[model samples]
Target: MSGYGVVIPAFNAATTIAETLRSVVAQSVKPDAVIVVDDGSTDDMAAVINALNLKVRLLRQENTGPGSATTRGIAALSTPFIATLDADDLWLPTKIEEQLAHFRRFPQVAGVFTHWRNFHHDRPDAPEAVTVPGWSRSTMMIRREVFDAVGPIVDPPGGRGEMIDWIARAREAGLVLDMLNEALTLRRIRPGSLSYGRDAARDRGYLEVARLAMQRRARNRTEPS
Candidate 1:
């Protein structure tokens, strides 16, 4: 992976987008290209991106769920490796640099994920930091071939299960996924954020993904290998 690209899926994130972009811009290892997918924001997200005049590309599409928006951004990029970032989240200066280094060390690993810290948008003074155990889209840098092997991201009905489902499927396919165990991404907790609160529809999507994963496992066990 000589070069990497970032895809940020945003919707009505006019307020926090600049901070997110700033984080990407300050990375120790700069991205080859940055693509921001404007998921039909009613807010001034487009205006804000344009106003910044940063070396980023903005693509607009009808209001699709974040999963679809992110997938669209991925499809538009030709980089060997890609990372996804939410418009509200921030990556530490060495986030990409460390991940690329890890990839160099373990070239067989198809994906690299790191621990992440969470902070509320309102609480910057003493932001509660934690090492998130599982993988999240925002914390991952994956080879493009992994997507070709795993298939497109699963767009759950209401949203919020794409990353989970993709990781599950990739694991089932025997992909080598390695973790750095360092908190590199800062996830922002804010009102109305999809990860902020529990929703029945979103929860159902997660359960459905779990169900499918289990089914696949069971079927694989029964098959004549």
Candidate 2:
């Protein structure tokens, strides 16, 4: 088995899935296994994946939201190291190689994230850096044991803003999150993306994450440190 595994949570990502898969397959240090979780996509995403035949695994499940799909994929991983790449995102050929090196150099870090360029499908020339506090899923490579230690991602009620909740839980578990400071991924920003249209929901998610992180910090201070 490959020492590393990648889990991709996809939903109707026909437009970009092929490119994403190719990017991973073409990596200098390919993952031992790559899993694509088809989260109840109504489109031809299945067909697209089947056509690749790149030795990657595909898991199909009913629409359970990205957080749950990701959780399931993490459970299915058999490697010591696991990374996440959304189906709509593209990774550099050296993404995995760089992350593995970082993990080796810093064994105590539970996860590593890289800088990424953001591009809109319609506007490819105007690629910009994605700068958000905390972490972005597209850039993170995590140790499988981190999940076992912290617990699986908890799906929030109403199936909204679950990613925020997952990240909060990780920080609470004292996982050392490190940034590689290299652009290893490209995130596609669609017109009506959650970062754009769902401003209110995104803000609420950010607030929740900040509050939990602060509370955890306060509690840590009160402890015998």
On lDDT, the candidate that comes out on top is 1
Model 1 per-residue lDDT tens digits across residues 131-201: 77548888889999998898878777667788899998898899999988878888898989888899897
- Give candidate 2's whole-model lDDT: 0.79
Which regions in candidate 2 have their CA more than 4 angstroms from the true location? 125-134, 157-160, 199-225
lDDT of 2 by residue, 131-173 (tens): 3432666778888888788776654444456666676678777
Q: Residue-pair clashes per candidate, as listed?
A: 0, 1
lDDT of 2 at 79: 93
lDDT values, one for every candidate: 0.88, 0.79
